[model samples]
Target: MTLDIVRLLELTGWRAFDVDDRGRVLAGSDESGSMQLVELADGERTDLTALPGAVTGRYLPGERAVVVQHDSDGDERAQLSLLRLDRTGPAELADLEPLVDDPKHVHRLLDVLPGRIVYATNRRNGVDFDVVIRSARSTEEHVLYDGGGLVGEVAVSPDSRYAALTVPAAPALSDQLLLADTMPETRADALRELTDRRAAARHLHLDWLPDASGLIVTSDFGSDRTRIELLEPRSGRRHPLVTSDSCDLSGSLSPDGATLLVQANDDGATRLALHDARTGAHRLDVEPPTDGWCGHPMPAPVWSPDSRFVALSFSGPTAPGDVLLVEAATGRCHPLTFSAAQLTGEDPVEPTAHRIPARDGESIPCFRYAPHEPDSRTAGSAVVIIHGGPESQSVRAFSPIVQALAARGHTVLVPNVRGSTGYGKRWYSADDTRDRLESVADLADLHAWLPTIGVDPDRVALWGGSYGGYMVLAGLAFQSGRWAAGVDIVGISSLESFLRNTAGYRRAHREREYGSLTEDADFLRAASPLNRVSAIAAPLFVIHGANDPRVPLSEAEQVVAAVRDNDLECELHVYQDEGHGLAKRRNRLDAYPKALDFLARHLSG
Candidate 1:
């Protein structure tokens, strides 16, 4: 039976929020910014939408409401109001009237302490982050951390004596954490040292010690290894804690700061280890289940509120993801039982792995999800789903989109291709610089290899989002006659244009990956799909978020214009209020139907 897109769209997941320490639930569904607070004791829900703009969220610790002042559709227009949620009622605490009026921007509340709230105002020009210390009693506002370079993960010590700020250089650049005392202008010195050091480290993680005497920083050396170091802010002395050549340690310090838990990969499987904060000694190791591919350890381990048990999402080569809860001290794990009804009603599609030889005779691992029907002889249409990050890998998971497509009598093939991580570091770095063309070749090679695995070659469609979106257009242009239809969502058409208009955080990094726009001008143009738009023959469906910061809306517009100039069968859909990806339930419901219709029209029998 074919899947009903309209009926499935109605079963949307409820917008749920994490319950606070006090058990108060706060969540919003739409862009209207109206936040609803649910009191767990009486099961009573209160609506808080009386503010000027939509309520982004309410802060913790003191239960303060933070609302961004905006017009209809929740567009940022500079004004931000911080209201106090007290027993007396919701009262205005601070009114920030028009800091900088930039359309479709975001003003996020970073931290809220006793008398101040640190926030950041980000526009297209880069994030102008500021530590705004505001008080309701007085009108004094203090600007602490304000400058450039991607600022985030701002943390203030428990005693409020020191503040630690992390500034990410680029996506590829190692992030640096600057620690400073609460005194005025203390962060200025740390920021200057950070600028001068120019740390080329790729991954950096930070956590404050128990007494706030020092900080524990973990930096990944990128060959599937990491080093943990402790830094004393006062003396500037760095102490090396632990170094693992194969295992990647994840998870931060415990809430009580008594112990630090780390998830590491050992012998092609994941194992959780507990470490002593002061001595850096491994105290306990949690052994995962013997079955399945446990080598790919989860990035972060979920610790319980009381720090008694640790929860992790684990999956094997053939099985779907299952949650595992383990005792913190004993390292005993208990797998939670989930029925088909509880997890998913969709039938499981068996995945068969194959090693396809690339252009350079290198074997690229590909996974093919075949239809569950008994009659395998019936040649069915196929969809090639490419994953984003070009650096990320396609793992076994319950994907609603893949299941929906398979239910409609179509085969789905998700290829890891070149540059995808998990296989090895060398395999990932192969697609760097001008090596993106190799990824394009891998797609075409995967298409040719589909027939041996029971998929009809002629009835194939290319589908992807983000970098995958770029691949969709690239496939339609370079291998025009191969696919019947293509779907590109927030993808790039011209690398040159993307380099000029991408988000500030990624501008330098992407230029390094694709090739510097200033130096390799001709090479960037050749790699772009816009230059080869004339070769595209397949029908295309282009979707983009109007306020997308990563790959700007102009990327979609330029591709659609090229398709129109070529007189190709192309349809463009842009959501005005969304950014990067669709966040609203209504937009997602609308997009899936249009996407299915486009693919059915072109590939379905």
Candidate 2:
């Protein structure tokens, strides 16, 4: 599945924030960098927004409209808009209207019901999010509950009488639930402490069973990885349903609420399980076509309006992310779109999932891609692609760049370093604050381990975005001689500056992982890669989104400037219309080519 650079780029597509009520896939195709929304049924795509940043939208539950999420210049403060599509109309943008267009606030549409929407926004005071019930037809809105902490992830009951909110238990990064009554007679302001922080669940996912008996929630209450439980809204007692050694979460509930889809991260790849909602019985287990793919964050498996099929998007080593419709009854999967309009050539060179031993004797898991087309040499170069989130895992997802590099004779190693998710809580929190460099050492260890696996040591390169970008800088600084080059994408240079400069709303959550500036200023600076620029002995390539609020543009600016002052070869690219990463295809088309050329020039095995 090694596609040509441009062809590989063109073939990658992902499911949008939407799967029409009919379950017909409306995806963001990769042909254009702007993320054009394509109706996968017919391969027709239409631009939904004018912005260049990333775009994710959901088709309103029962309406002929969609609610699109976008932010200006890559700032985390996003704007929401409603586009009531008119297939009969002549123009695409004709029926669009401003839904929530505030500059200082971040608006997230949690759930859309028959005639209303459950939304969370920091517009209340620009600090913490407040859950609100807004009329789908009018501007009428009512504050359901105002919690001091992060009042996000609003899940509305089927009858539209109740809403569930996830409030962060800060410092620990765990979360609890807040139940709000949204019925006409019931007091909207009356909120109940649905769950407590004493028994914390790091990831709280909620979904109302069809009859609204209570909620089907996935929590880490009594298990290391998350487990599915049925929470009785009245008694506030939970009945355990599905528990596993791997990370598991509740997926969509059937219309009648009988079948509940559950996705679990068994090792690095995902396994799909279907449970009987009423009995808490595991009825069936279904894995996607690909053995390893991402199912946690975005484009999760969605159930059809009929509840007979579950639509899921996944990416493997050679395959770009593809959408599959699974038949719930028969356990059969049918491809909606193979993460694109078409996937050309033979099966992609599937990656081998293996564990590399770490210095601390812990096992670090990774997906290794050996190039299908290697150079005419006994040994070839290697590249380690790091994932962001520090809370995120680098599964065997379809990444065009990774596949392209492998095709170009470079072995791509995507490691799930210590701090990454899917490995359980202890491993995920292993790289907190001062211990962050240990995660970089995990990469260095992978670099050192490459020789044993037949990769040339001197030609290895480091590549990552955001926190992973920070890893790039950390590798270049702390392990100067270990790499041939480094490619950093929107990485942080200073933890202290990032904490202070990031949007006011996101600082607290970030501090829970990275050290807090108020307490760890010196340690933060010492840990910052920009402070150790003199030790970076490799050619560096930096990419950033000017509107990136998490790692501000200044983070990239300072590093590029400082690295240039060291009299080394440092190439910096800043996209004005992009943020954090290249959301717009035009920006990616320009940026990635430079990346390929840079890797080729520096990684000469």
Give the alpha-carbon lDDT of every model. 0.63, 0.75
User: Lowest lDDT 10-mer window, candidate 1?
Assistant: 32-41
Error of 2 at 134 (Å): 0.9
Give me the overall lDDT of model 1: 0.63
- Write the residue-wise lDDT of candidate 2 on 1-605 in tens digits: 44657767666566644565455665665555555455545444454444445666777777777777767666777777777766543223334577777877888877776666677888877777888777767898888877666664778787777788887765354677877886545464578877776654664667887777888887777666777888898898888877777564545667678887777776666777787878777888775564444343245666656677676766655556666767788677676665533565444666788899888798889988888767764247888999998888877567788877887788888899988877777787688777878898898778778888888898899999999999889999989898999999999887878888887777866776787788888989888888898999999999998778778899998989999998999999988877778877667778898898899888874
Candidate 2 regions off by >4 Å? 19-23, 40-53, 89-94, 183-189, 198-200, 246-250, 287-298, 339-343
Error of 2 at 311 (Å): 2.3
Q: Could you tell me every candidate's TM-score relative to the true structure?
A: 0.75, 0.92
Model 2 Cα shift for residue 486 (angstroms): 0.5
Q: By TM-score, who's the top model here?
A: 2
RMSD per prediction, one decimal?
5.9, 3.0
Residue 2, model 1: Cα distance from true site in angstroms: 7.6
